[model samples]
Target: GDSTTPDAIRTRTLTEETARVFRSRVVNPRWIAGMRKHGYKGAFELAATVDYLFGFDATAGVVPDWMYATLAETYVLDKENQDFLKHANPWALHAMVEKLSEAADRGLWSEPDPELMDQLQQVYLDVEGDLEDRVS
Candidate 1:
């Protein structure tokens, strides 16, 4: 007999299915352009973050989709909270990124806690140095 529980269901998600669903959506370039507001520096940081999280060996494609799903879910669960995470600290930011990487490793992407998000945002902002100037 198979047990049915929310956690179990989530744990059993198929990586291939996740990837297929993402590919069909026809992503909007505006979003990528928006994220590019950070420019190459921002892009580097995000790439590094993803690399660190999901192990640098292989399966990079799977990790990004998981990252997107995690962020999307977080956004849906608590938009306000996610916004706050976009405003967190440096050390905390690095740590949250690591957590995300770990989640990706386990094939279970998830949104960071508000506190972790805060740290990540803060770190990125702090290291970014005058994000306003860079974005514009």
Candidate 2:
């Protein structure tokens, strides 16, 4: 008997879950070690690394509001992260934008930092535009 749900949806759900499990069990430990070796500091760096490894899905609802809030706060306060943000990978910038936008849309953060959101949006737009130009 066929289920009412679509096959694509089911497959995507299963794949995402499997990936999450794999990240937790296998990738995270090794990634942590590497980050430590590279002298990465603070929870924001760790969270960014997780987002990079897992790949951000705006529709997946994987990133929590608390994480977004923490990221926003860190972005403003951490001098090191401030410099790193300028050179962040395109994918990482996109992930940060998606997560922060999601949090803002849901009114998850009590007071969303407009400056932080604007900075991330600018980076995301610039990176995406650059990619598009490269493709074109």
Candidate 3:
């Protein structure tokens, strides 16, 4: 008999499992809301997690492009989360946006949505101006 088992259907590919975890837990609305409840510390953790995702994908060839795209959409580009970070910790927001953009620029998210990139660039500019103003 072959080594393949009937339960092979339950075995998800690396990408599929990664996507499942990311959507169900990492980017879930409830999880995001819960993180936000912790104040600035929560915001910092969110940004740090993004960096970790980026790093793992950079080193290992497992993460799919859509994961990055969806994460950017659900976390950084969402207006509600954007507003929260802008007020609670603009620097974290800025870093998140910058990392996403870097991911795109490096082709980690090859063929990223043009419109989303445009929106992110605009947000980056606005956030940069605000930070500069605060310094001035």
lDDT of each: 0.43, 0.51, 0.83
Q: What residue runs in model 2 are displaced by over 4 Å at the alpha carbon?
A: 1-33, 36-67, 73-89
**Which segments of model 1 are wrong by more than 4 Å?**
1-108, 130-136
lDDT of 2 by residue, 1-110 (tens): 22566773433464465455544642344554454344434334654644543344344445444445555555423445444543444344445556566557765544
Scored by TM-score, the top model is 3
Angstrom error at residue 24, model 3: 2.2
Name the better of 1 and 3 by TM-score.
3
Please give, for residues 1-136, the per-residue lDDT of candidate 3 as tens digits. 2236775546676667666778787898998999899879888978887887788778865667788878788877899998888888889889988998888888777788898889888989999999999999
Sort all candidates by lDDT, best to worst.
Answer: 3, 2, 1
Error of 3 at 39 (Å): 1.3
What are the per-residue Cα lDDT tens digits for candidate 1 across 13-97?
4455444434432123344344446644544444444444355314543445444445434322234433343443333334444
Q: Each prediction's TM-score against the native?
A: 0.24, 0.42, 0.85
Q: How much does candidate 1 score in TM-score? A: 0.24
C-alpha RMSD by candidate, in order: 13.6, 10.6, 4.6
